[model samples]
Target chain A: MTTTAINTKQFMTSEQLLEHWQGHRNLTRRVIEAFPEKELFEFSVGGMRPFAKLAVELISIGGPALKGIVEKKMDAHDEESFNPKTKAELLNKWDEETEVINRYFGQISEERFQETFNLFGQYEFPVYQNILYFVDNEIHHRGQGYVYLRALGMEPPFFWERF
Target chain B: MTTTAINTKQFMTSEQLLEHWQGHRNLTRRVIEAFPEKELFEFSVGGMRPFAKLAVELISIGGPALKGIVEKKMDAHDEESFNPKTKAELLNKWDEETEVINRYFGQISEERFQETFNLFGQYEFPVYQNILYFVDNEIHHRGQGYVYLRALGMEPPFFWERF
Candidate 1:
């Protein structure tokens, strides 16, 4: 059988993928909430960027990438644009972006997932792969936040409890 | 349209999923290789488990879970079964398990991805979700390893360079 024939069966619906991504996002938001303001901004092990900075990087990517995908715009990637001076401000932007994600994500039809889209004018891949990268990148960074929390003698939300 | 109808288009092929997962495994192996022998087992921040122990947890999960799925076995989850004293020994077992993953992963029919499998007599999820958990869990721990390496003044493999 041809590759296309064998792959005709769905691995997941667009809605299921959105739910999965949002679940991870919810868990990440909790990780951000677990930190004290000082540690979120200043704590680091071995000079790695602080958890707050990591959160900023994620915030920069998700909504912007989805907007780019839907709009077919390859704007240059910008990680420095959104600077949250406090945890509360950061959380507000995060909550707002979640809505941005929901809106742009809904605009992607099933057929669009298989089409290649150059993400942020770089890293060209199928739309689904780009979306997977967003989720994967979040998990990787949240993993770092988990370590930071542990090192601070604080408990992070369970990794599996992505609601 | 019914959810099933909307989902008829493929999100990814089984082989593509395997490739994506193995890319992660390859990067994780690099993380293991970066650690000093003593630190791999004994290093910690805030009493978190060392990278070696985290690696052991992953080693215990992936191949065994696939075996359980292919053979219809639900053996109790065991993280303490394989203890590696040295980095060499750990990498050896990692290589063996990679082959084991390749072998057993091949036996799972595409249709089986949707079937519910109670993994390790613990988490009951669709086989694909269980597999994803394995990958997600690996990335999570590896993220910790990245932090540990940074703290130790060592550089981890780039998160994006999985291959």
Candidate 2:
């Protein structure tokens, strides 16, 4: 294998990491799917932020950050804004962004792994750190998803496997 | 606050991020706490992996990743050999890692944000991507955390807000 290909293979071979990412996204979709349209924005824990807001934040973070990576521009403020009033709308946007993530991820060159870029024009960090941040940010909010699921007494997807 | 401080406040602010991170760990801990010890290791979703294995993965990801960031070493493969035996042990380790993250984050200067680093010695992603991955990975698994919580009839943390 070429050196770049070999390196990619070694990193991409992390089944757990891949599974973890896909699984979490799948689960987040499920949680959104499970919520009643009204509850999406109203649900909270102790006057905390609403799941809807958090979802928007997640969507906002991914595409814009990727854009920042691609364009090598730092967003000084909230980069992308999508306000979906209904569950269907949010899901559609979610799916669209998911595709964006996959497409962007596919475009990542091994040579650019160490490249530094600014996200939101505020923090100048490396490309890898931002990517991990995207995944980590998603998982963090998805934890909230679990709470919402439990509150609704709805059975969420099985946690053991990501399919 | 000065303009620069104001401009960079969001990126420099680790409080919300840390809250999200800690909140996730706490929720995941709850998932494990709710499960019967025997089932912790045996429970599977759709013939997939068990929650216990997933937890181990979470613990393994955090410490070494943070260490990598602090030390500015990208090719750290120390995560491969980490395996914690008990829930308490993992929790203790997690607590320590949380502190580590806080300390490391505090020490990072705004000027140094763009430094590049490798993750797992494979991806040539930047330092930003690495940090993002650290948090994103946690969120992914934490989604499973919701599943586990639901299965156990326990309420996970609220999805919308960090407390």
Q: B95, model 1: CA deviation in Å?
A: 1.2
List candidate 2 segments past 4 Å from native. Answer: A1-9, A13-23, A77-80, B1-163
Q: Quick one: best DockQ, which candidate?
A: 1
Q: List, for all models, the DockQ compared with the true complex.
A: 0.57, 0.10
Please, what is the whole-model Cα lDDT of each candidate in the order they appear?
A: 0.88, 0.61
Model 1 chain A weakest lDDT span, ten residues long: A4-13
In model 1, which residue pairs have backbone atoms overlapping below 3 Å?
A46-B151
Give the lowest summed-lDDT range of ten residues in model 1 chain B.
Answer: B2-11
| lDDT value, candidate 2, whole model | 0.61
- The best candidate by lDDT is 1
- Residue A149 of model 1 has an lDDT of 91
Q: How accurate is candidate 1 locally (lDDT)?
A: 0.88
Q: Write the per-residue lDDT of candidate 2 for residues A1-163, one digit (tens) a residue.
A: 5434322222221222333466667777877887878888787654445677878888888766776677777756572557778889888988898777755654445445456777787757566556656766676677666566566666656543345
Tens digit per residue, CA lDDT, model 1, A57-138: 9998999999999999999889988889999999999999999999998888777887999999997999988888899999
Cα DockQ of the candidate 1 complex: 0.57
